[model samples]
Target: MTNPLFYAKILLFGEYGIIEDSQGLTLPYSFYKGALKFSSLDSEFEKKSNTHLTKYADYLLDLELPKGFELDVQKFQYEISEGLFFDSNIPQGYGVGSSGALVAAIFERYSITKYNPENISKDQLKNLKKVFGLMESYFHGRSSGIDPLICYMNLPILIENKESVDKVAIPESEEGKGAIFLIDSGMTGETGPMVQIFFEKMKTEGFRKTLKEEFIRYNNACIEAFLKKDMNPFFRNLKKLSNWAYEHFRPMIPESIFNVWKKGLDSNAYYLKLCGSGGGGYILGFTKDYEKAEKMLDGFHKEVIYRF
Candidate 1:
């Protein structure tokens, strides 16, 4: 049987704000993807993945899943013994759902009660998020489960709140010069520590207030404007969101990309924001003029994911 492929994801908005029940928008990023495969474990990559899967299988065996949701852990263990490894090109720690894809692959293959992504309802989507949260927590210590859910459904999801999430339709890409892109930060980011920092920041009344009143407002507005194809409002809100991140998310921003983030705001050519937890990995960028933004961001690597 051919292994099913799982794609990477990008959380366009609502990074830390989601924990506080703010709205979020996430979409599949197909440029990088992964799949489950059996290998001889000869190559170092295969051997390492096999070892990790062994440990992950052990973890799954002890996990207490929600009622009616269970993994065939015995089969998973047997497959690990048979040199089952995740064959993926998604970059780990890039905030693009590498581990999430792996988790989705495991669930798709081993779940006792299968839920077809195409036929799932809103309630089922919520339950899937809860299950994915429990499963993906092994990697991040705490998880919102958005990453794995996106990978599993392979669809754009809009989070209305903690208990309300549904599939969403986005504007189709166009041949225009504007674009949504990713910029390589040239370093890997650890989600756990960055999340820790965000939690610590939450302790401050001022920061929490700003996040709710400013950050989330801009985030949700951007999502709404983008969906309606209101470019003016979208870019306006995006600029605000990008500026807010620069001012408040300083700790999460990697030092190397600090200047580049500021350069965008200053030049008005493009706006940049966190692709995930920041501190490294890929930084998301939006530009009304991709060519100008490309020229401004000359030294850094960039890939346009959506054009308008």
Candidate 2:
């Protein structure tokens, strides 16, 4: 039997804002992916993956999954003992959904009741997100399940709010100079710690007010403009969103990216924001001219995910 592939994901918008019932936009990033596979477990990497899977299997066995969603834990354990491992290139702690792809792959292969990703209903998608949240929490300590949900669906997901999520169609990439890209920070970030920082910041009434009034407003506007293919408003709101992150999400931003994040705001050549929880993973960038942004961001590893 052939194993299915699960792709990495990018939470393009609404990283911390989503927890506040704000809208979010996420898309599958096929550049990095993972799949379930059998290995001899000779290499340290393979052995490590197998060991993690063994522990994960134990967690799943004790997980109280939502009704109508079930994994064949016995089969999962048997496979783990048989040297089953996730073969993936998705960079861990990069905020590109590494563990998410692994979770999606496991659910794809071991779920006792499966819903077709191609034709799933809105309720099914919500249920799947709930189940994924429970499963992936074993890794992140706490999870919103959005990452695995995007990986499993392999589609752009628009989170209208906490209770509303559905597949969305994004404007297709064009050959124009404007682009959306990723910049590697040369360090790994822990989602748990970054999230703790966010929660801590949330305790401040001023932070909470700004997040709802300014941050979410810009984020939702960016999503709406991007979906409508309105470049002017998209970039306008994107700049605001980027600046908001720069001012409020400083702790989440790694030291290496601090200067460059400001440089974009000053130059108006590009804007940078957290790819996921920030701390040190990949930083998301937007530019009207990829060439200029490339020149300004020299020495940093960059990959363009979308071009306008």
Candidate 3:
């Protein structure tokens, strides 16, 4: 009955680079969340979701390989059989961690080991990412488990590298002038194909060079500057990261928002980045001046997340 909701997550920085051990900053977005509930799943969406969860439960049981992230899942099977399903509004395939939230909810409700503080360490986060990656891989072709971990912990997490993650405090919204917001694209994104495209692009020397030299540099620097609360460096690197994402990661961006994304970067009014794996869902925006950005985004609905 009383299942806590796991919110969606946004990978603020470090997208493809995170796989190569780049630094990442992730935050929970509560605007969309999922919670386990008992209800008559009569609607098509509800029935399909319930059925998918059943299959996922089976997938969890079927895993017998060596796993760094293991959990006692027998209890979860029992719950799954008893009408356990996540009633969520978070749209799947939008790259906003829809399946990740569900995976976290299941683990939080059923995982026997409580690795909160004493047992939880960076090693544990790695183990978790591995296990969660396997578990969530049932939903998507591949996963990093970072999204599920963010949803499970319900805390902002900073990825020092692929092997380490730690809880972080977000800077306070003191002045309320600058803001972070999301612009909805109203379309779902496919993860597997997009990832394939990225891999193909990586095979090209020029693209790979840009990814390593420019994208990684700006993305990693942004993480450091943001964490250090060095405003000037943070904004400076944000612009760079935003620009890089626009140029090289255009395929991942939604076609509808491409123009707005470019215009924002060009004008320096606001810079847009992929909220998740791009394709669609919500595009995250950062601007020193929200009113100006809002005016620029007049046609689309922009939801303010934070201000500083």
Candidate 4:
């Protein structure tokens, strides 16, 4: 049987800053998605996927599974062993939330009991995120689990702060030249090292202060404006957020795209930010005029995520 698919997620705001309790806004990308499905007792990719899933199920079973967050580890392991495979089109390490989708799908389909997002309290969401974080840590050494929760719920998730979260709805895309897009970095990035570097930088008071006061402020504004359907304010805040990341989180941006990333900001043709961990993967871009950004970023292939 095929489980429901979870769309890939993009952390529109709160990339690294979110780790410091910065406000975050994340939504699902329907263009790319993944789901757990049973395969015939064959196919290398299927077999490999099943084996990997089994290992994960075992890990979860070993963990002191937290309260409120529930999943049928035994049955999930059995089903996965009985030919289950995660069949997905979402690209891994492209910062599009590959592991997130899998975690979402698994939690959704096999959870012995489910927590309803509607009647559920905010604390429940946080707890779920914590549990999912522990479960997803199998894939990435560390995880916020926000991506998986958003993907799993297929809703716009807003992180009010470290302790509060809920499903939200952002303004729908408009018919216009303004757009949100992704640019391939042409290399894969691992979350572990990027997170390690982020933690290392967190040791500095200057960095932490800037992140809390400046970066998070702009990031939160961007989320609020976008949710309110105020494109003008959204772009205004996006520009500031992009600039903040460029200045403080330089290492996250790859060496190759460093100039282009900066040029976009300087020229005002577009503003680019880390789609995920940055170092390498997909770089997110925002521009009121897609033509201008396209002209500036000639060689790199780009996909429009949303239009405004």
In candidate 4, which residue ranges exceed 4 Å CA deviation? 116-120
lDDT assessment of candidate 3: 0.81
- lDDT of candidate 3 over 103-123, digit per residue (tens): 888777766665663346777
Tens digit per residue, CA lDDT, model 4, 22-80: 88888889999888887694888887888888788888888776765677888887887
**Among all candidates shown, the one with the greatest lDDT:** 1
So what's the TM-score on candidate 3? 0.93
Question: Positional deviation of 158 in candidate 1, in angstroms?
Answer: 0.6
lDDT values of the candidates? Answer: 0.94, 0.92, 0.81, 0.84
lDDT for each residue of candidate 2 in 60-120, tens digit (9 for 90 to 100) = 9999887688889999999888889999999999999999999899888889887889899
TM-score, prediction 1: 0.99
TM-score to true structure, per model: 0.99, 0.99, 0.93, 0.94
What clash pairs does model 4 have?
none
The TM-score that candidate 2 achieves is 0.99
